[model samples]
Target chain A: MRRFFAAGLTLLLVCAATALAVHAADGTVYGKGVTLTESVPIADLMADPEAWVGKRVRVEGLVVDVCKKRGCWMELAGGENQPAVRIKVEDGVIVFPLEARGHEAVAEGVFTRIVLDDGLGEAHSHEGHDAESCRKETRPGVIYLIRGTGAIIR
Target chain B: MAGSAPRANHRVRRWLRVIHRDAGYLAVGLTLVYAVSGVAVNHVADWNPSRVIERVERPLDLGDVRTDDALVDAVGAALGIDTPPARTFRATADRLLLFWDGMTVEADLARGMATIETVRDRPVLRQVNLLHLNEPKGWWTLVADLYAVVLAFLALSGMFLLRGRQGLAGRGKWLVGAGLALPLIALLLLRGGP
Candidate 1:
């Protein structure tokens, strides 16, 4: 009886460990897990982004690109033909991994718009990418940026 | 009085040895962890210490796929995936990006070429790096602070560990001076740049 119980317990523990590993393989959170219950679609936010500016909102989309150097910012895919939005976080505060590029992410942040100087050609210096990299704009002069607080990528 | 002074000096040295031995043992594991992670992170410009990224390019004949959905379907089929992509982006007229968990596909619609990138964590090193970077910064900050204090105690206690030849009063002082001078010299030389 004792031997049978021991064998059954070992099998149960093994099964539990395997289940956890499988679950953990799917998701990773940076900074904090998203708290906003409702998330706005990227298309809606892009339609009239000025209305959403300064408002704390949550958005969910597939991560199309991430900052290769510092993991500081990530570009999330919007609608099929629409432009993606840049979710920028503080350096070293929340590093969105490069592998997270293909994963779905729910991110919460305040949306802010920045106007660029054409001559100086400053393209979101925090990203450390090429100057033309902040091309996720629907318009020519303005850029939509989210000061991200937290995110969950799965 | 002379004997007492020497005895007091001996007692202080004995205590230093005891504290140094205990702290040294306690610091060994964390010291090794920080030292290894420090070297790895120091050269982060060259490589990602926590994750390994692999890229492959293959000739993918996506055919005459016009719509975004059709393009994603074709790439998924080529990549041996049954599920639809998590997201798709039409980066340009010629370039399309398909994203999935742990994988990304960048395709050139005009050239029929696809570049796939996949990423995976580097196991124990990833966790160690996180600790060293203080990524988990709640209770860990306190722990790290305590470790710093222990290390300081070890360094100060260590200076008095020996007596004459190999001790701080002898060649040990030169060794310590050299250790400190190297970093100062490097800073003086390289501080103007990176």
Candidate 2:
């Protein structure tokens, strides 16, 4: 009876050790990069895009939208009238459903440029007007688009 | 009666041990895959997972480019359009319209120039993302359902792995209680319950 009890105890210890190892490995593999706080503003990101490229950085904000089909893009609000940055899901990253919108999040990933247009000409033409009219209408709402890659949506 | 009872008890314990060990090992990798992907998917508005690698501008000489077949062909050639343009229009006085890959582009007529931008999805994570949704259909959905069932089993079996004071009756009970309470507390604090 004593021998049986000792053997059972050993088996339980082994299982516990295995579980701990698995959990530790996951944290090491996926938890790469730095945390984001309110002090680190969008202006700071724009100031040094090259250095931050391909490096994971976290940002917190309120979600505005999610893709109805595949979760391709999500809009995050910074402040009122401030152009919302549309966060794109990295190729393999899976985000949750639309219910997550309006929820605050801290996401980590590399910041990259997603310029929708190289010039203002596309914006001007879409409104069915000349350069002056396009400039008058589109200029006010112009937004510079930047996307993050390998993002973990928290 | 006692002899027969011992044999049956031994058989039951043996089967339980085998099932617990095998299932635990099989679930390790899959558990992490789904957990990480699920968290990322849940918070979509926070970030883009894909990266835009490069953007280039190529100049073309359309030379009085008009809103006709010839102009479209010239524009297509200059922009390196792999397939026929999905749509084209007169975007403005100096620009012509073109659309591809869920985006619109405008080319300058006189300069024969257009900007070409390409975005490539991030590797590994992109495929994992697809698995998270089981979007491919047929076999994938079946696999996802199986995974869900296994997860439920894991939760249940895990409770019985230990016994006695340090096991489910004492410390184990406390651990399980804490696990349940954490999620309940978060739901109450964050969403105010339903």
Residues B1-194, candidate 1, lDDT per residue (tens digit)?
76999899899999999989978987998999899889888877678888787889888877676777887898889777798877677777888988777777889877888988887878877888888988755556777999999998888889998998989999999999999999999998885411
Tell me chain A's TM-score in each of the predictions.
0.72, 0.45
lDDT of 2 by residue, A1-154 (tens): 7998899779767865775565355221112322554324444555566655655556655554444434545555443323345555543344434434444444555565433344554433322212211122233333333344423334
| Model 2 chain A lowest lDDT segment of ten | A127-136
When summed lDDT is taken over every stretch of 10 residues in candidate 1 chain B, the lowest stretch is B185-194
TM-score (chain B) of candidate 1:
0.83
Give the per-residue lDDT of model 2 (tens digit) for B8-127: 856775776678787877778778878777777675445443322244678877766464677778877766676766555543456665545433345666566776544456576656
The 10-residue segment with the lowest total lDDT in model 2 chain B: B45-54
Model 2 scores a TM of 0.46
What candidate 2 keeps of the native contacts, as a fraction, is 0.00
